[model samples]
Target: MISACHQCGEPIPPRSDDIQLCRHCQQSPPAFDRTHAAFAYTFPINQLIPAIKYNRRPEALGWLSLVFAQMLEDRIDSPPELLLPVPLHPWRALKRGFNQAGLIAGELGRHLRLPVHQGLIRKRRATASQAGLDRSTRSANLFGSFRLTGTIPAHVALIDDVMTTGSTAQELARLLKGAGAQRVEVWVLARTPTKG
Candidate 1:
């Protein structure tokens, strides 16, 4: 399969096992500490993601988690104390019968032998999807959105399906920090390249 670089949109060979970003990412990096993704959010990924989300294809999760775990194993030093999934609003979760991020995070926890903690909750309900929203609007929509219940582990990793503008991760990290989490690492299945 021909996969393109998630950052620069350059053609990536089928054997490009060790690459996630193009040269551009090395030049200007994201705010998160470390990011490793299984596949670029295009082609097969684009097809698979929506299928899993809309069609309720839970079977795809095993392969997704395996790919994610392999990518993560090569990047991080060790497993974090806890894995925190980016929470969906209760209504959305109820409607969908599952949170996609939560399912992926649970699989990651099982694969990595780490604990999955659903300590974070979405305090604010968002009617608009984050997609197509500007960074400022995204920030506003997610502002004061996440709240942590009970004790948070000293070291925690936030898990999500994709990292786009990163406002969601940033806001969640801020909440985690406020809740006494000493460090936050983002574990995403894909990171959308910034558009030029």
Candidate 2:
């Protein structure tokens, strides 16, 4: 199995020694303290994620969440105090009839015996999908997009289905820390390989 970056959870090339930091994370760290992802955003698994997100396949979602929960249990020695699904804009949640992240978080929370807090952070406005956008554009699009609510916990894990450039996770983690969270970790089902 491939090793992952200790900070961002992106896959690292197989190596002889244990190097925990990826080059990008070493140069400039992310807002979150750490990340844990179950799989790379590739192959048939990639197809399954969209099917759960866009195609409204509950069975697929359940199975994927179970797999992710097992991965989390295997990797994390101590679970965070809470689980927070990356919030969706109200309009988007209404249109989709659900937030994919929330659905996954719900299952993970059950499996981990952690509380899933849905209202802790919310998207203030809808932004264009991060797909196909450059890293700078993705950051700009999410600027001031999330608002923190409720009491911020000392330790929390932000849940999402996929982490691509990690712009979204970065923005949310910054906000969480600003709102008094001592440590924020990201838990995602899959992570895309970093661009060269």
Candidate 3:
């Protein structure tokens, strides 16, 4: 079985319990209070998520959304009143033709019966791709990249396909909390495994 941290959803370290945070999450707690994810970002998942993002295949995530929703149904006692998909910069959205997070949020909304609010959180800056960056670089790159375009609910969830370093989630959750969100949770299809 693949066990995960209750806090960040990263795979629990060997011999560790699931109720604790991973080392990284403990050292630098994420801005979001909790993370809900279905699987680790490995094997077929690593391949499938990239294809869904780069290949414009939102349809491929349908089954994954349903499965994650099932997990959410069992785990979430207090669900978010709204869902916000991490937005892309206008230029990035134009180039990609869609935001994968938005698509994933939409699918998840239907399965989880939450209202997905897009355009509420806008990516105003077009920073370089975060693929090869370290944690600090990734955090700096996202600084001031996001803008709140609309009001937010007190309790809300940020929906995305993957949670890698949690940099993006940290930035967005900070933004949301700053904008009056009392509780912020993250829901994702997969979370990257920790490097030993």
Clash counts for all predictions: 0, 0, 0
Instruction: Go through the candidates in order and give the C-alpha RMSD of each one to the true structure.
Output: 4.7, 1.2, 1.7
lDDT of each: 0.73, 0.88, 0.86
lDDT of 3: 0.86
Ranking by TM-score: 2, 3, 1
> How many angstroms is residue 153 displaced in model 2 relative to the true structure, after the best TM-score fit?
0.9
Stronger candidate by TM-score (2 vs 3): 2
Candidate 2, residue 8: the lDDT equals 89
| TM-scores of all predicted structures | 0.81, 0.95, 0.93
Candidate 2 backbone clash number: 0
- Scanning candidate 2 in windows of ten residues, the lowest lDDT window is 52-61
Q: What TM-score does candidate 1 reach?
A: 0.81
Candidate 1 lDDT over residue span 1-196, tens digit each: 1454443333345543676655655685433444455666767787788788889887788888888897777767866898888988888877788888888899999888898976455656644689889878998888876767778777888888877767887787777777787777777777665566
> Across residues 1-196, which tens digit of lDDT does each residue of candidate 3 receive?
1667767888875664444677777787878999988888889999999898889787887888888888889989998999999888888888888888888889888988889988899888799988878878999999989999788899999988888888999999999999999999998988988676
Alpha-carbon runs more than 4 Å astray in model 3: 14-19
Choose the strongest candidate by TM-score.
2
**Candidate that would win on lDDT:** 2
Q: Report the lDDT tens digits of candidate 2 across residue range 33-113.
A: 998888888887788888777877756778788888887788887789999999899998888889989999999999889
By lDDT, the candidates rank as: 2, 3, 1
